[model samples]
Target chain A: MVRFEDISTPARLAEPGEGIGRDELSLATRNHGLPLEALRYDLTPPGLHYVLTHYDIPYAEDGDWELTLGGHVERPLRLDMDELRSYAAVTTRVTMECAGNGRALLSPRPVSQPWLVEAVGTADWTGVPLRALLAEAGVRDGAVDAVFTGADHGIERGVEQDYQRALPIETATGDAPEILVAYAMNGAPLPPQHGRPLRLVVPGWYGMAHVKWLRDITVAAESFTGFQQATAYRLRQEPDEPGEPVARIAPRALMVPPGFPDFMSRARVVRPGDHTLEGRAWSGHAPVTAVDVSTDDGHTWNPAALEASDDHRWAWRRWHFTWTAAIGTRVLCARATDAEGRTQPLEQPWNRGGFANNLVQRVPVHCTGL
Target chain B: MVRFEDISTPARLAEPGEGIGRDELSLATRNHGLPLEALRYDLTPPGLHYVLTHYDIPYAEDGDWELTLGGHVERPLRLDMDELRSYAAVTTRVTMECAGNGRALLSPRPVSQPWLVEAVGTADWTGVPLRALLAEAGVRDGAVDAVFTGADHGIERGVEQDYQRALPIETATGDAPEILVAYAMNGAPLPPQHGRPLRLVVPGWYGMAHVKWLRDITVAAESFTGFQQATAYRLRQEPDEPGEPVARIAPRALMVPPGFPDFMSRARVVRPGDHTLEGRAWSGHAPVTAVDVSTDDGHTWNPAALEASDDHRWAWRRWHFTWTAAIGTRVLCARATDAEGRTQPLEQPWNRGGFANNLVQRVPVHCTGL
Candidate 1:
């Protein structure tokens, strides 16, 4: 029999000249990215939204489901679906992106899910505030974290366990960024593919923190070092290094390709003349303040008009640019700057796990008369 | 300037020892497959269904959209969304599989979308039967094919054009297998990713035949010679050889891997005990009549109990087998046999385009105490 504690290295960069592996291809086939064209919509339709499921989408009947709050909590409670839905519901639009969004684009890329720049989406979620539940459960003194456990169980690296991740107590119950136990998406009951019945939704954070198929919320007195928290989703240069944990999503901007694409290569072709280029930009750190567009690669940048409002503070803001095209091959790029003054980098520093590498998008287009 | 007709080879295999290219990886990111665990659902959720779009999903408002039927039809007609919906609607469950489902599994695989099974789903489609529309338009006596043109346009292999495919006139108006102009899926209006407003759903055929973002139906006096119909999706051994066209889906069965999986490799780990091996089997040629299960790869097979019914003529059938697990490592496989005496091949013949490959699935698992 194999020992349970014999775990292996958590993250490794792909060897030189190594293309995407079959295992990574398998993950790609199962999870999907948002087509950059889908940026046209303010709230992405569920089917068009990018998805990254770490394990099997757990099968659960909502009627028979229960959520338990225990451990360091003063009042341990178990609530069924009906009891859970009894709480007042609030709906909010939030943009969520995977930490590994640009993994495949990295040099000596990580050998995990091979994602491009499309692994991001904005959605309207409806649920009860997590703060309300925490208050009702009565948190005890000295509770450092609230561990959320999902029904999805699987092995990661060499350790087998249910999917679990913890949030600092302040972040979990903070008023500035309301955390939710969402039961609905875009006004409809959550579909099976998107953590049906119920799921956790943490605004302004990367998708990994929003545990799906949630079953338990255990208030803990100490930091919880689960496999997902301390192992996989981290930034490190070497195998022995204890990397900084990945948390909030980095600022990013993506433009809708201005013209039709080649079927296989996806190279764009457009007619010369006046055209309006539009896209969406977001930052989990702060509200997006400015967006810049470049027609001749990143050599020169022009400020674009931003359509921002107080209503979509946690969601992506729309931006547009008008250009008079000439002809020949050209490269287009877009970059965003958040209110915190953090602009998207042209080239991100490489890390072993390939987390939060939000490099500006570069699109190639051939302009000519159609 | 690039000439419009300067086309290259329609299909080419990957160079020996070369891994999947970045272009193929890009396609994999945009498209997605049904997770094997999702077989538990009877009608697949739209977001989880396999999607393979050759070009951008055309944006069209339902109120202004129209489908034109002309050429060789005695009474040419243009029908708006309202007019189309006024016809009697039929709802049918269909299991659609991509023609290139097992493309990546082949040696020197075709360098396009790198799919490995999982590219299949069953859905309840609601729409007007194609025969009714064809009868109203009155197909002319000399008409031999009904050419479908979708609004999605792009360049494939150096040739730029709108997406187009064709069905024999008889097949388009046949009673045995009704084709539809589908507008709704799973009782809701079709999502944007699934060709919102209107699309063609050809029952008992590969997904390529179900043209999405449909804009026109032109009856022709000759068979279509479009790139998708005449070049791509064809089964061939050499690039120079004109091969047989890919149409119906071949017989195939996939088991839901027992127990949990390793997050990276996706290899299953099960506790040593009795487990029910369950899966879904399907074929476009005919109803699935039998299913077989093997624990030791394909070395030995045992008959499985099929839960088939005439109600789901064009949909997949459920199958189950009981197995006792007490092993270190095991490879489980499932195979299906259709009513037409066609059984899934143990090993599929290699083809240039990788179409209609139905090799039995092999799932590696480790059975031990958790």
Candidate 2:
């Protein structure tokens, strides 16, 4: 078992020496604390994984933190941290990733962070159900959306900036216990960098919706449009304009491309004999139903053993496969299929920034005597 | 004229005491910089406005930015910032608002920015024509989505993060100069916070499509997804599930609601006397053909003067009306009708995280001695 000391925090400070431009870190290429060669099973070894958040890291504050739920509701509420924790606690092992994972791999390598693959990670999260609070608040009819805000602030276009995003009411109060108002990560109180007091853990979706340092919950018939909603997280192009303002387009939610590959194409160092290949698979909208591995690119394929599905359907599943090959150079690949019948593709279509990269996993490896 | 120095830089830092909640800085409430009273105008002020982005602020380098056009074209090439800027430059004043503007005003205020009512803004933007770039780049048949990415970075959960979004091809290569690769804002170099080196500015739609710090431009047949596309800025609960996970729902682009009010309500803070009221009107799918104002809270109404339309068909138009009232208190309202005959409603349907809040505008004013 890997010890906690072996877990290296992937967070890096934006320093001058760190070349700007595409050199910045991105979801697709940030190096986690684990070897890219090792393919683990079940839980993502804390070292080799991805992280997600909605707002900037909250400051360390011990002040009284309260969550208020009001507006159009039968009964308004103000729940403190302790009060919220006292309620039934639920734990879920889910896979959470940034919406833009795998972006760096896009051909032409979009201008954002030149992520060298590995933009996702899975963790067992623990939190309270948001629905219970809504039930306690007695939701009223016409409650359209729920707005979540965080404590971090910055300067955007020289204006005071605070991050905010909204979720539909149905999702906020759904039967699935996956939507969590979380306080813990990987079985520990969230660190200051990861929304200490409170944050949201929304499985199957990108990290943006899981707001950090969550402070207020308001039920409304209308949607909210703070900086994050109206301007920051939006598309700006015209529906028929055909490449006028490349960015100006209608805002749509992030999606895991239907044909995206589920597992990472990786190789493990092995002796010149028999060996097994392993990896993991997950989806944003559905559960990982199966994983397939390819030994010769797409020329041939074989089924891999998949771990049991986790409590959170949005989380990813671990898988492994054994194969014998002549010691030499080989191309390895993996693919995933979700419950919705979506499967990984051989290659992803090229986009400007490489948003949803679900292309088949391909890794080239050279064999040496072990 | 508002002098540059006297104008306060059109930006401000967030106050320390500001609460940490989505609604605290939402456009809906007066406290969030977007005052409800400002909605009386048809054209949103430049200072009080909305902006969108795909990546974090890019490091503003020299004229290092370039525009590339290739794929199924006669010639594939790259145009640096100077080369692209050498082409003809055009300027237009337009109103750009999030599709979910006024979302917070909904009954339950869906789960988005708790906008208290101010998610709209107008700006005088200058940029190069997209047609020129396409002509220089060359077009292809199978091209479907034009993806955009930025240089911003953050940590979500425990991982590094980057922002990205995409738009359809038709919107990328449109006829009108509505789409712009903007380097200047309000006739000056765009501040770093607003897409410094370069950005896409498509007027008349939600903000997500306008990718900031744009880097790459790809022509493809399929849409990409990271977190932003598949999860964050989507509309679920269309059929209205009260408490479902947001991921289970399919994402739909922002749509103009049916039966919306034609004109925004107007009010004059003056002694009991005759005064003229004015505001703006427009639609997402169609232009605003006319607007009508009501002083009796919808009981009676009068037609307002409509301004000539602009090149940006999706832009809102200014309208005004004169009315007489007795001393005391009065409620004013307005509604708008789009070219397609869709009218604003007295109240918009509630969704989770209040999106698409286009209800009729109602203003309450107190009258004094004549």
Which is the leading candidate under lDDT? 1
lDDT of 1 by residue, A211-263 (tens): 99888999999999998888777788887788998888788999999888887
lDDT of each structure? 0.87, 0.54
Q: Model 1 segments beyond 4 Å from truth?
A: A1-10, B1-10
Question: Per-residue lDDT tens digits of candidate 2, residues A185-242?
Answer: 7786765545767888887666667787888787888877665555443322322222
DockQ class, candidate 2 = incorrect
The residue pairs in collision within model 1 are none
Which run of 10 residues does model 1 chain A get worst, by summed lDDT?
Answer: A2-11
User: Which regions of candidate 2 are displaced past 4 Å?
Assistant: A1-41, A45-49, A52-56, A156-160, A230-271, A310-312, A350-353, B1-370
DockQ scores of the candidates = 0.64, 0.01
Per-residue CA lDDT of candidate 2, range B225-262, in tens? 55556544555555332332221101111111111110
TM-score of chain B of each: 0.97, 0.74
True contacts kept of each: 0.67, 0.00
> Which lDDT tens digits does candidate 1 get at residues B243-322?
89999888999888888877777777788889999989998898899999999989999999999466989999989999
Q: Which candidate's DockQ is highest?
A: 1
At residue B211, give the lDDT of candidate 2. Answer: 68
